[model samples]
Target: MAIPVTAIFDIGKTNKKFFLFDENLRELHHEYFKLTPTLDDDGFECDDIYVLCNWIQNTVRKITSSGEYQLKRLNFSTYGATLVHLDADGKPVTPLYNYLKPFPDDICDQFYKQYPQDEHNLHTASPALGMLNAGLQLYWLKYTKPQVFQRIRYTLHFPQYLSYLFTGQLVSEPTSIGCHTKLWDFSRNRYHDWVYTEKIDHLLPEIVPASKTFQTIIGGHAVKVGVGIHDSSSALAAYMMRTQEPFALISTGTWSITLNPYTKESLTRDELNRDCLNFLTIEGKPVKASRLFLGHELDHHLRILNDIFHKEARYYKQIKLQDSFLKKIHNHELTPSFYPATIANPLLSQDVFSSDNWKPNNFESYEEAYHHLIWGLTLLQVASARLALGNSDVKKIYIDGGFIDNDIFIKLLQYYLPNYTIEVSHMPLGSAHGAAMIMQGKQVELVV
Candidate 1:
């Protein structure tokens, strides 16, 4: 007999993954692929929309028609800060623009002049992030590519666009709209005034509930298709489901994000200035969050360290928890020297790390030097996490994603945040599992 399964497409910046989960959500099978990006008309590299779209179609057809497993449902969780523009006839009008693609400085300056700094940004809970503010892409299009913009029928966030490929439905959900995109006004619970005032809202499709799903027949079987969700918000779903108490999730990958959903404070200018922003859950509530480029910075630091230490780059993995080093820190014997360079967060300056920037000359061995590196990195991590942790009584912190494997990093985190119970998350399939779970349950209410 064939097994009944649900498929989830979990797409992040570096990898695209497909996973099959059984009735109980145990992963039965999984595969990953990397799409070779193509250059857009403006010479900036972007996702090969046509190739990616074709890949999605071919993959789904193979799965549905295979008949080895009953395909009961499907959903997507994709990175935010991307858009797929479609024309009147429901075809892509331009390349899927890369979020990191530079917005012209002159144009960006003009945008701020119109919207202004605190006046417009504070209301949306969005920080000034150049092209990272996905909504600004609309203005970039209207002003620079009017001919291409004029033909647009609907502009879909990438996840919804992926869902549309299967069900032919256009949707806007809070998870994508609320992701520092400068599109949503959290207080009013809708598009920001600038979006409507500028008439950029016209290009947007009607928003569907994040929980909404469509039933469709495919390959002689009926399937439930979800409305799609942003990857970060979707990743938080599984944690939100299982944990009964208030907690913070430090989801680490290319970026290390500290998310606290229990906070009552509205984002202040000070918080926003430190790269602290808000993300909406699938249910449309704020997940007060902070960001650090610690993951990427670790890689960069390792490359430099390997060159200096004359060892294989992966040496850190061999070092277990440094009990002797911990004693030094605990006894105030290690006057830690800091390294100034860390990965840059767009919303904040590097000045926060400079005060303690000490040299690595004092270390006798690579292990000692590595400990120093982590100590400096932890300082930045703490600052980012504190943005969301302010005045909250969250007694537990759940560290998820890649950094959970780093004992040194986790131990430093525990030492720094001794007031909280720190534990590594057991679930690596957070985003995919979260996307699938939302299909069966009632909407989760945020903790007050």
Candidate 2:
């Protein structure tokens, strides 16, 4: 008898990964592949959906025919803020538009002008993120590209679309819909009024729980396929399962998202302006989340510093957390000298951090300068994390992903959030693991 296994496709903006886990949920094999993106109709670079679809189908056939392990289940965890519009015949009507594609300013201004209430944002728990709001993408299509909009019969978030390819199920999950898509009304537990007013909700499929699964045939083998989940919410689900205490998670990557699922406070306008939003759990409960482009900023600054300091790439990885450096930063004896006034804003621009300002002669050593950068970022992180925490009594803070290896980032976070117990999570479970776990009827308990 072969070992029973589950396969998970963890798709990101850049890397696409496939993982197989045994009956006990231990990772057995993993493969990482990068897909080349193609330009959208607007010439903005976007995912080549045809390539992705073929890769997924080919991988499934290859796995099921191997006869090494019995493929029992399949699921997906992909980035949010992207949608796939389907024609009446269930074919893609438009390119998989990149979330980073700049939404037209005219369209954005027009939207707010028509719906001037700040309460609109609060109710949906979605800020003015332009193209990042999937619902706005539909709105953009309706007004700007009415021809394309007219041909659409259904709209599916990226993850569910991937699931649809195999299961033939057209459904939406809360985790994807609730990810600052400007579609879900978090307060009312339904589509926002604007969604109906615009008739964009008419294109969306029936809502389903993230864990909902359907039996399907693949390469002559029977498999259970999940409805799929948003990557960030999927990650939080992993931590939610291991601990029973009231805790907060800082999932660090290109974006450092601090999530507090326990906060009871209502979403506020001020929080929206400060880049705070809500992500939904698998069961459709809102999780307060605050985000920062921390990793992007950190890497951007590091590249400039590396050239100035004449150090090899990743030299900052060798630097340890120095108490003397940390103390001066904490005491304000040494300010975040390298940062400009625009540091107050979480959004980044080329002019905000000019490489000319980062002179090597200004610092005693690379370590000192690096520590200052981490200190500054940690301060911002503390502030962002606090927004997610709000009035919640969560005392435990778990740091996961890229920043886990950065000693300075971890220590500085600990210094700033002293009241909370901050620790690095070594758990192997990530978004992919969480998606697989969901298919097994597992629920993450948060009661302490």
Candidate 3:
């Protein structure tokens, strides 16, 4: 007999994954792929939606026909701050623009001037992220490409778009809407006023709970298809289901995000300025979050250091935190902070470290310099994490993703947050697992 299973598509910016889990949520199969991105009309790189769509359809057909498992359900967990615009006949009308693509400064300046208080609007929980705020993408399109915008009958967040390809259903969910997209008004619990004002709300599909699914027939089999979820929220859902206590999650990747689902305090403007925002759970409750460009900063500086120190790319992975090195930093024996004490800035900058930004004379060895880098980032991370923590009496912090394997990063975090229990999460599959759980209607309520 074929084992009953659920199929989940966990799509990240660089890695697109497909996974199968048996009835007991045990992994049955997993496939990973790296699709080459295509360029937008203006030559900016973006996801090739057609290529991704074909891969999904082809993968499903191959698996369903394999007979190794019964594909009972289908769902998706994808990166947020991206959208796919569809025409009236449900055909894509534009490229899947990269979230990092620059949003014109003039338009951004004009937007704030119009909605003077929006920058500090806690109700939206969106910072001035320009293109990173997906709603502004629609605004940019409407103003710059009115002809293309006119053709857009609907716009679905990346995850929902993937779900729509299979289920043929048009819908939205809280996880995507509330992920610093600037579309959701958390206080009002509806679309933001700017959305309605710009008439961008019309292009958005109907809103649905993240756990809601549609009964569909796929490849001659009945399937429960989820509306889909943002990757971060999906990962948090996995922890919420198992962990009974209130805690913060430091989900690291290109961006290191500290998430606190238990914070009761409202997001202050000061917090917003410090890069703190809120993400919604699958249930539409706000989860306070703080962001830091950790991985990006580390990668950038590591390249410079590798050249200066004549070390391999992966050398830093083996470096561990040394107490004596940390003590020098704490005792002010190390003159001039390598990275700025500013929590909102990147992990490392030349501004405060040395005159030319980087000076080889600052350190005797590559390992010593690496230790300083980690310590500096950890100092900023402590502040960022505290912003998310608020007054919540959370005693545990779970660090997940790429940095979990970085000993220096993990150790420094533990040292800085001595009052809390710091743990490295082994759940790299948390997002995929969480997507499956939502499809199974097994979402557990998390009490703060």
Kindly list the per-residue Cα lDDT of model 2 for residues 1-448, writing each as its tens digit: 7778999998877568899998788899999888988999999999999999899889988889888888999999998899999999999999999988999989988888888748778888978888888889998999999999999999999999999999999998888988889888887788888888888777888887776889999888899999889888988988787678999999887778899999999888888888899988877888999988788778878887788789999889989998887777667686344552323363422322334254545887778778777866776788789889999989998888778999888888887788999878775547887898887777433210
Instruction: State TM-scores per candidate.
Output: 0.92, 0.92, 0.92
Candidate 1 lDDT, 4-84, residue by residue in tens: 888889887767889888888888888887899999999999889888878777877888888688888888888888988
By descending lDDT, how would the candidates be arranged? 2, 3, 1
Q: Comparing 1 and 3 by lDDT, which wins?
A: 3
lDDT of 3 by residue, 220-251 (tens): 89989888899888888888888899998888
**What is the TM-score of candidate 3?**
0.92
What candidate 3 gets wrong by more than 4 Å, as runs, is 118-120, 327-332, 335-337, 340-357, 360-362, 443-448
> Considering summed lDDT, which 10 consecutive residues are worst modelled in model 3?
342-351
Weakest 10 consecutive residues of candidate 1 by summed lDDT: 346-355
What are the per-model C-alpha RMSD values against the true structure? 2.7, 3.5, 3.1
In the predicted model 3, the residue pairs found to clash are none
Candidate 1 accuracy as TM-score: 0.92
